[model samples]
Every structure is written in structure tokens, then in C-alpha cells.
Target: MTTAAGRTLHAGALLPELIAVRGIAAVAIVCAHALSMATRGHGGVPPSVEYARLIVDFFFIQSGFVLAHVYDRTWREGRFHYLTFLGKRLARLWPLHVVTLLVVAALVLAGRAAGLETENPHTLWSFAVTFLMLHSTWATSDLAWNWPSWSVSAEWCAYLAIPLFFLAADRVRGSAARIAVGLGLFVACAAFSELVLGADIVTLTYDGGAFRIIPSFFAGMLLRRMFDDEPALVAMSPRGYAATVGGVLAACAALIAMNATYDALWPLMVVLTAALASRAAQPKPGLLRGRALAWLGELSYAIYMTHAIVLQVTFTSAKLLGIGHTFPQRAALGFAALIATAVVAQAAYTLVEKPGRSLMARLLSQPRPARAFAAAADRTGAGR
Candidate 1:
């Protein structure tokens, strides 16, 4: 799908397995949030819940890798239109973001009208920050409307600066050296966050979110470059592929366990993300490439954006229907809420996300009538 500008748009590069990983990560996040809400600010959380926070790191790294895989050649060839790239990325992300933002706003208003005590009062400032995708740039403010959107805000920042990162990465010589530099920078950033900023990279808010994304994102880009330079690396035997996947999973589990005590395993998380993404890019027979998992991957963004709203609405409805406060009852309701979230997310993907993307692409891709007419007049004048 290369444009006239020599920009290659490789649709086949859409890695289904990686997409499945995204869906799984989204599910983990939903479970983590649900557990947090269920516990009502209690200290106890499953290891999975705590570990799920690292999934955002996976997202950052994956974004870098995927974008680089798709667009780096276009950029190198000088056909990468900044506005076009930004518009496409926004079209993919913004439709769902706006839909979910409005949904949350409506829910907040409805709750207020019914005299229900809402934890986060809707404010114009919060709305403005969220609508502009700037909520991840500051520390003091919170958008209770859609709390998880903070990451989307951070990702928006990344999308805007991707070209700059790509340009910087272009200057590097060898893929191995590039990867090493990226890893070193990532570790340095993590150390700075811990030693100087006195904040853990995992739980950092606002500005810290921006800091958290940079190293991992570039590391992903470097990893993608490595994949391109070394074909043999991606062409693993079935047994070797299985072992690589198993090794990464085992390492992740060990890191998650260590994180429970040490709290400084974020750099290791970058390595795991890169490894998983590199392997996932290969055409391999794996569970991640199954039809169901692939479909879930396609719906992942919708799930990630809408799950919080779904959970909120479900719990509110449960309360209205006099659901019991017992732990067993709450657990059952939570499971039901999760299932409902998936259904709603599927509907959102089918209804809002797909249509909105198509509409946006068509609108953005079309040339203005005025421009066309002016070009015609110029050609006519030249003929005379």
C-alpha cells in the first residue's frame, strides 16, 4: 500500500499474535482495575494485579516496534507525511477515546442527578485536559471521568513525537549497537526515576508517565531494526520458537516475583517485551495466532478504552438492583461485569471504532475541491 510519495504501507505487517498479546494485556489491566475497585483501597492485591501494571510497558515497546516496522522505511525514503501519519494514528485512537470520554461524562452526570456520591467530580479543567490528551503531562490533576485514559494521553504524546524518535534512531549504525544503546538509556531513565525523582517507574503519574514510555518505546524501535537486519533471528525452528517463548514467559514470572520484594525490575520488563515482540512477528504456529485470539486482538483497543466505563455502569446497576455486599456475591458480580465489558467492547469495535476510522480516513485522504480547481487552472494557463 505504498502511496505516490514512495511511502510503503505494509498491511501484511499487522502481526496477529502481537495483537493477541495486546488483548491479553488489556484483560489483565481490566482484572487489575476490577480487583482494586473491589477491595476499596485495601492493601492486598494478587501478584497478577500488581504485575499487570507492567503491561503498559509492553504497550509502549510494542508501539515503538510496530510503528517502526510499518513506517521506518517510508520515513527513510522521505515519503512520510507528518500530518498524514498523525491523522491516521489519531483516527485509530481518537474515535474510541472520544466515545468513551462522553460515556463517562454522561455516567457522572447521571449519578450526580440521582444524588449518588461520585468519587471524581466532573470538572471543565479535567475535561479539557482529557479531550486534548494532555492529562499525562502533569502531576496535580486527575481525570476521574476515565482514569485509565492517562495512558492513552501518554501514548498520544508518543505518537506525536514518533518521527523525531525515528529520525534519531536513523543515525545509529548497527542494529546490535542500537539495541544496546536503547537498553542502556532505558535503564538510566529507570534509575533516575528511582534515585532522583523518588518515584517508582511503575506507579509514576502524569509527567512520570512520559518518562516511563520513552526508553521502552525506543528500545522497541531498535528491536524492530534488529529483526530487519537479522532474518535468521526471526526464522526460528518450531522447537526453538517454543523454547524462546517459554524462556521469556519464565523470565517474566521470575521478574514479577522479584518485583514483589525489590521493586526495580522495570528494565528487565523492557527486555521481555522486546523478546516477545520479536518472536511474535515471525509466522509461527502458536496459540496467539488462533482465530479467537486474533479477533480479541482486533478488539483490544475498544476493550482497553471501554472496560472502566462498563465496570462502573455494571456495579452501579448492581447496587440499584440490591446486590448483596458479601464477598462471594461481589466476586460473582465482578465476573459478570467483566463478561459484559467484553460484549460492550465488541459492539464498540463493530459500531463506533470501525466506522469512525473509515470515515476519518476518507475525509483526510481526499483532496480539497479548491486545490483541485486551482491545479486545473494552473495547467490551463501553462497550455496557453
Candidate 2:
């Protein structure tokens, strides 16, 4: 590989801004869950937290873009191994998913045994299905054990379809065509969800979330293609970058002001992603590149995986202690839950996620006894 004058492939691969966005999304979802927990029997939560659910779409889109950026060139060069790619992804996702799933199961079982009512459906069959990462496709209920894991199940679906999405997008030539195809997929999926499923794409989780992830994931891959074709999108001056992001924000706000549907916000999301990505690509100061934010990004998956359990514990304890009723009490409880969520997420990341990934990497690195498979693995650099 011929290298660029100033950029290493590893450096180009890292997107601090997007990572920061992931951190923000993780925190937002935690907040939304916290509000829900606190307001279990109280008055309705604020409208803003209700809309936080849309950030899941952002995760789907970001996953597509980042994975494509990392592996597309290898695939195009005939050096991509599907199994190895899948293994690496599983290493990233499965450890924490299993941990959170078990934690939720124990909580539910203990609560039931103690004669306390639990809201989420946590049946044995559902647990087994979720353990296999098939909950999104196989479940009968929406909010089954560890409800947030639904997105992870949907993500597994996207990972399985990576080769297909890449091949499909690869055949479409030109930036405009790629954009059209990407948007078309998103719109088509949204349309099907509205017409047949009778739900907005954003609201589709557990039962119908696979449909939601497909288009968003494909669109994200397209966006990565466009960015590769024109890396200069990230070369804007500071003032220009600020103006571009501000304009996108204004457009998003206008959509909200008009009571526009969720589908209408899709393009703005794409634009905003591009803008932030561009700014992050630069060496200059940018909106989402601080140390704390980057750390949050690194801990994002842990936060997402563990927050539901932490919130459940927090709320349950609060209820037992007879708090979270009045406005001040709810606010304080929500704030406390948020802090505890972050602390627990950090622990999960340190204890479970990092070690599991390292172990998987080491296992994948061990020499294969089968000569033919080893040869193919070598050609593909899949062992790395």
C-alpha cells in the first residue's frame, strides 16, 4: 500500500468526532431510560427524552460507515475473509451483550421469586433466543430481557449482510448514483415499515428492528464510499465548518418546529454526520475531539450494554426507598442513576469487554493446523 504523505492508515481509520458522537448517543439513551424508570408511576416524561430513541438509527448508520471504511479496501482487493471479519465483530459486541443479558435475567428472576412485579418480559425461550443473538428475528415480545440488546441483535443481522451490501453498493458507479441508491434503500425500508408494519422506522425494535437497520446500514456504507471518493469534505476551514454544522442544525430544528415526520430527519442526519466527520478528519481544533469525549466514545459500547441494568437497579432502589415522586426527587434520582450508569459502564468495559477482545484476538492469531485454510487466511491477512 502506497502511503499518503502525512497520513497513516491507522490514523485515517480513527474518527474521534464520530466516537464522541457515539459517547453522546450512549449518554442520551441512558438519560431516556433513566427518565422512563423514574417516571414509572409518576407523570409523563419530557418530550425530548421520547425522541432520544432515534439515536439508535444514528448507531446503525455509524456502524455501516466505520466498518465499510475499515474493510472495504481489503474486500475489494480480495483480502477479506468473511469469517474473520465476523469473528472480529463478535469479539467487539458479544462479550458485553452476554454479560448484560445474564444480569437482566438474574434481576428479573430474583424480583419474581421475591414476589415483586417486573415489567419486561423475561421468559426462558426468549433468554435462549437472545443468548444466540437471534432475538431480533425470533422473539415474540418487543421488550424482552435486556431490551437494549435488541439493537445489538439487529447489528448482528447487519454484520451478516455486510458482504451483500458492499457488493451491491460496489456495482453502483458514480457518487450521485451511490447517494440515490442509499437514500432509496432507506426510503424503501421506511415505506415498507409504514405500509405493512404500521409503524415508523424509528419505533421498530425487537420485532421489526431488522428492517430498520438494513437501510440505515446500507446508507452508511454509501456515505463512506462518497467520503472516500472525496476526502476533501473534511478540509473545510474552521469558520466554514462551523457554518456548515450550524446550518444543518438549523435545518433539523426547522423540521422539529414543523412537526415533520421522522423520515424527514434522515437527510439532515446524513449531512450532520458528514460535517462532523470532515471536521474530525482535520488536524485543527474541532467540535467533538476532546479527551473526555473520546474516552466516552471508547466506553460507548459498555455504556450502552450496561445502562439498562444500572437504571433498573437505581429505580428499584429508589422506589424501595420511597423517592422519585415529586419533580425534585425525580430529577435527583435521574441524575444519580446517570452517574451510577457511567461508573458501572466503566467497570464493565474494564473487566469484561477489553479482556474478552484481547482473548479473541489472541485466539484468532494462533496458527491454524489446516494448510489450505491457513494459506487463505494468510492471503487475506485475516489472522491479524
Best by TM-score: 2
Q: Give the deviation of candidate 2 from the true structure as CA RMSD.
A: 4.6
The parts of candidate 1 lying over 4 Å away from their true place are: 1-12, 41-43, 260-284, 375-384
Instruction: Give one digit per residue, the lDDT tens place, for model 1 in 1-384.
Output: 322233222423666667888898898888887776565534457665677777888888888878888888888889889999988988888888888999888888888899986777478888878888877877435446787888888888888898889887988768668867986887688789889878777666565677778887888788777766665555545566567667767876776667553234555555555555545545446777888888888988998999888778877787899873566666676787789889999999999999999888888888789998998999999999
Q: What TM-score number comes out for model 1?
A: 0.89
Model 2 C-alpha lDDT per residue in residues 1-384, reported as the tens digit of each score: 222233222323678888998999899899888877677667677564566776898888888888887888888899889989988888888888888888888888888898887766678888898997878774657578888888998999889988898899889877889888888888888889889988898888877777789888888888877776664565555787788779987986777777678788787777777777666666655558788999999999999888878777877787788876686787788889899888998999999999988887777766677976878878889656
Error of 1 at 67 (Å): 0.2
Pairs clashing within candidate 2: none
RMSD of each: 4.7, 4.6
The prediction achieving the highest lDDT against the true structure is 2
Candidate 2, run of 10 with poorest lDDT: 2-11
TM-score of structure candidate 2: 0.90
Error of 1 at 314 (Å): 1.9
Model 1 CA lDDT for position 211:
71
